[model samples]
Target: MGGYGSGRLHDGRVLCMGGPWVSAIAKDDRFVAGWVTHATRWGIVRGRGNSGGMGGLRMSYRRLYVPGATYFFTVVTYDRRPLFSDPVNVQLLREAFRRVKQHHPFTVEAIVVLPDHIHTLWTLPEGDADFSTRWRLIKTYVSRRCAKTYQPPGSASRQQKSERTVWQRRFWEHLIRNQRDFDNHVAYIHNNPVKHGLATTPEAWPHSSIHRSP
Candidate 1:
């Protein structure tokens, strides 16, 4: 069988895996050396040609992947650009969500669109716990249609991953444990604008579900 050779790591470092070959480059030292040492110490044999990279860098501690479970999410824009400050961009985001819902179909229990980010509560359809796909599609759709201006510079890691500065690399997610959890998240969503000094009250935020809510 063929052997795995030096390949590019997530941080753009060359990972040489033949016989104890190490790079002279100092930049590769941090990630490569640590991973190699860990594998050697633990006797972890990784698959050939596998440079472990899950989209972008690891952000979440542990993602709960229970399909059809209710979840709360906080997603922010790139550089906190306040893209949603304009009403048109806000409408574009809403339209993007609407179109995605038409196809993938998820229940938006609560939602609030802030200038720089969004807070939302969504419940997947039964037997379908794939919120990641939904968020990906939504971001893609909005990026294509939304009003975009100058974007901040993305680092070497983010650029290597082909990620955009349009939105933060990752979002914060919480699985609603029970009724209390759900209620608390909904309240948080409603009050986010006020907390950010964008509004005086939840009812004052026009881009929230509070108006439709009881």
Candidate 2:
């Protein structure tokens, strides 16, 4: 049983419709899972399950596509595995991003890598709003380079599609509303390690783009 409300989205784990952005409560509630025009018009389609629910069951979200627009994303490893804890895994992920960017360009505005998950902001190239493709390539690259055999098994649906079990089949994304939203999400990305007690401060997290700041 669920219904829609003014759900709030933090951590880039949820997407908002009908407005510039949204924040959500953690529980599963009926969400307005639909597409939105860059002109701020919403096409509402109701949906169930939480933001990070099981794959294939939660494709109700028709991602709002906006070319060259800035977006925030959160992606997680299967079963919350600390796949990024190893330096080799981390380096592989960086290489995956670079490989994807070489073909499909996107600007990495802000990024933070945690042991089990990652949050990032990106600006797609002009006339190219296919962030989904970029993510697919990045995940595929990393999974191929750092294949994990003991990972949790994929859902039957995922198997049918030949999807990777290393990463969650779904990711959370939000279109940046404005400069203030962009700034706020970037800070959130930087502060994530501290929030999770992985670091004393954002700068202490070596796996983040905060280290790029001089």
Best by lDDT: 2
Query: What would the per-residue lDDT of candidate 2 be over residues 60-117, giving only the tens digit for each residue?
Result: 4546566656778889998888999888888988888888888888777678889999
Clashes per prediction? 1, 6
Count: clashes, candidate 1: 1
Highest TM-score: give the candidate number.
2
Question: How does each model score on lDDT?
Answer: 0.65, 0.66
Model 1: lowest-lDDT 10 consecutive positions: 45-54
**Which stretches of candidate 1 lie above 4 Å from their native place?**
1-60, 146-148, 153-162
TM-score versus the correct structure, for each prediction: 0.67, 0.71
